[model samples]
Target: MTETSTVLRTGRKFDQVLKGAREVFMADGFEGASVDDIAKAANVSKATLYSYFPDKRLLFREVVQTECGRMSEQILSMVDETQPAREVLTVAAQQLAAFLISRFAQQIFRICVAERDRFPELGRAFYEAGPRNGCKQLMDYLEKAIAKGELQIDDVELAAEQFSELCKAKLWMEVAFGVRTSVEQAEIDVVAHSAVDMFMARYGV
Candidate 1:
């Protein structure tokens, strides 16, 4: 095979393995799932799975991290420097809520909670790599808004974290427990509006 074709095939196999791992982790839980099952689901051998992910823990970590990164990227991409603070916040909140309501969010949260006792490091890694990084990004946006006089905030980091909590509260609980049957656009609008309203009440000049 040509070098480019070989690279593309390898990348496709890696994606297949990752998708398989997510399915196994979601269905069997982190500790209950085995590498062989994942390989079977991915139609790859154990050696191939191991080559792609050194261990199951690492595979699970990558799954969570990939989902979180996608969410963060979506939120970050929506930020417009020239837009009003409230508008930017509304957009960001909507993006965040949408992400928190996804199937991947539900599965990742389940894995984190289930594996906390057996693999505390996995839980910590999830928090640090996902929410913590997201909070930092929010803080950066808040700081810029404050500097621009678009918003007033004494504690940007604290405000950012609070904003996240406000945006995620209901949907997060629903996702974490698999309670919500669906999270509609109406729900997203309601949560985003409420979150933006509260945030503005505190920070608007």
Candidate 2:
């Protein structure tokens, strides 16, 4: 076979493992999930799964990083210099808030916390992979906005963090604990606008 076919075959198997791992992890949570479970779900041999991911924790992290990477792309695409800061941030805030309370995000958070004692680095790695990645994107946008005189900010990092936290507002804690299960778009809009309001009060030009 050609090199291209070999590459495609390898990539296909790699994706199958990830899809299986994600389903198993989401269903069983990290601590309870095993390599055998994932391999069975993926329709691959245990040895094949091991070849792709030697460790379960590494597999879990890869699942999260892959998901977060997709989301980061969507969020970053919203940052348009042609639009005003308020317009751009309002949309970003809504999307960020929605994702924060999403089942996927909540499960990842729960898994990291539940297994933190055994694998403290997993929590930190997840935070860096998802939250820090998003924070950096927001920071980059803020920095560009400041350079263009669209906003005034003394600390871009703090502002980025604050904006995301503000977007979370009342929804994050409630959703994480099962006190709430769903959020309406109207509510998201309200929270996003409020977050933008507070952020602008501090940093708007």
Candidate 3:
């Protein structure tokens, strides 16, 4: 295979492994899941699974990171310089909420909460790879907006964090507590608009 093709194949295999790990972890929890089950779910041999991931814990960590990374990328891509600040912020928040409400996200949250005691490292990894990275990305975007005179903020980092918290507050709580059944797109839109309004009132130019 050409180098590009090889890279693509490797990425596809990794994605397959991540998807399998998500199913197994969600169904069996961290403690109950096995490497064999993940391999079966991915339709790959144990050797292939091991080649991609050294161990089950590592596989789970990768799964969390991949999900969080995907969400972060989506949110980042939604920012548009040509758009109004409020509109940009609203879209970003809505995208973030949609990501958090996804089945993969909910499953990752459950895994972290349930396995925290047993796998403290996994919990730390999740927080660092997911929330911390997400907050950093938001802060970077907000800082750029402020520098461009689109926003007026004394503390970009704090504002970014608050923006995320506001948008995610209810959905996150519901997901964490297993009370959220389905969040409609309309509800997401409302929350996103409200968050944008509140944020703009505080920092908009």
Candidate 4:
């Protein structure tokens, strides 16, 4: 089920609930987080939490969607769509690399994978809200670049996906696999710029 279809209601405290849910989910994960803890963290009564989100799954999904929206907006604000593919893509790749190595993103990804067998829909929802959404944003920007004769992409969707993977390269895998505790800015720049260079080599006109 989609994130929007799962929302039961909204009110003044909607954002407050979401903030609390996000914190708890990130800390305790989907299965470990409890309604009581979420309610306490939100400083809302159980009844109030239930009124806003009837199910824990709905709350978790909402948090995921909200976080994804924030990430997309952050990247968009950092990127200049009017710029050439090289410039715009360097910024985009840097942001993507930063996010891929982020603790929050890693935890959300792990949660989805860890619970996928029991709650397959959560995995789908996360994919649609997170990775797929990011690709769509990149696709839009790539289309604009194509129209401007800056890039010559045969398949915008595939190119977007490839660029994202290129950003991950060796850094994200190292972080995700627990081989690295943190990534330096230099490392991010190296990976991000290399990704941009590789992408432009393939797609730039």
Each model's lDDT: 0.81, 0.86, 0.79, 0.89
For candidate 1, the per-residue lDDT at 183 reads 77
* Model 1 clashing residue pairs (backbone): none
If both were scored by lDDT, which would come out higher, candidate 1 or candidate 4? 4
Q: Please identify which of the two predictions, 1 or 3, would achieve the higher TM-score against the true structure.
A: 1
Show pairs that collide, candidate 2. none
Better model by lDDT: candidate 2 vs candidate 4: 4
Q: Model 3 — which ten-residue stretch has the worst lDDT?
A: 1-10
Please, what are the lDDT tens digits per residue for candidate 3 over residues 130-175? 7789788778778778888999898877898888788886777787
Candidate 2 deviant stretches above 4 angstroms: 1-10
TM-score of candidate 1 on Cα atoms, chains taken together: 0.89
After the best TM-score superposition of candidate 4, give how far the Cα of residue 6 lies from its true spot, in angstroms: 4.6
Supply candidate 3's per-residue lDDT for 98.
76
lDDT of 2 at 37: 91
Question: Estimated TM-score per prediction?
Answer: 0.89, 0.92, 0.86, 0.94
The lDDT leader among the candidates is 4
Instruction: Report how far residue 182 has shifted in candidate 1, in Å.
Output: 1.5
| lDDT tens digits, residue span 118-139, model 1 | 7887788689878899899888
Model 4 poorest ten-residue lDDT run: 1-10
Model 1, runs deviating above 4 Å: 1-12
Which RMSD values do the candidates have, in order?
A: 5.3, 4.9, 5.0, 1.9
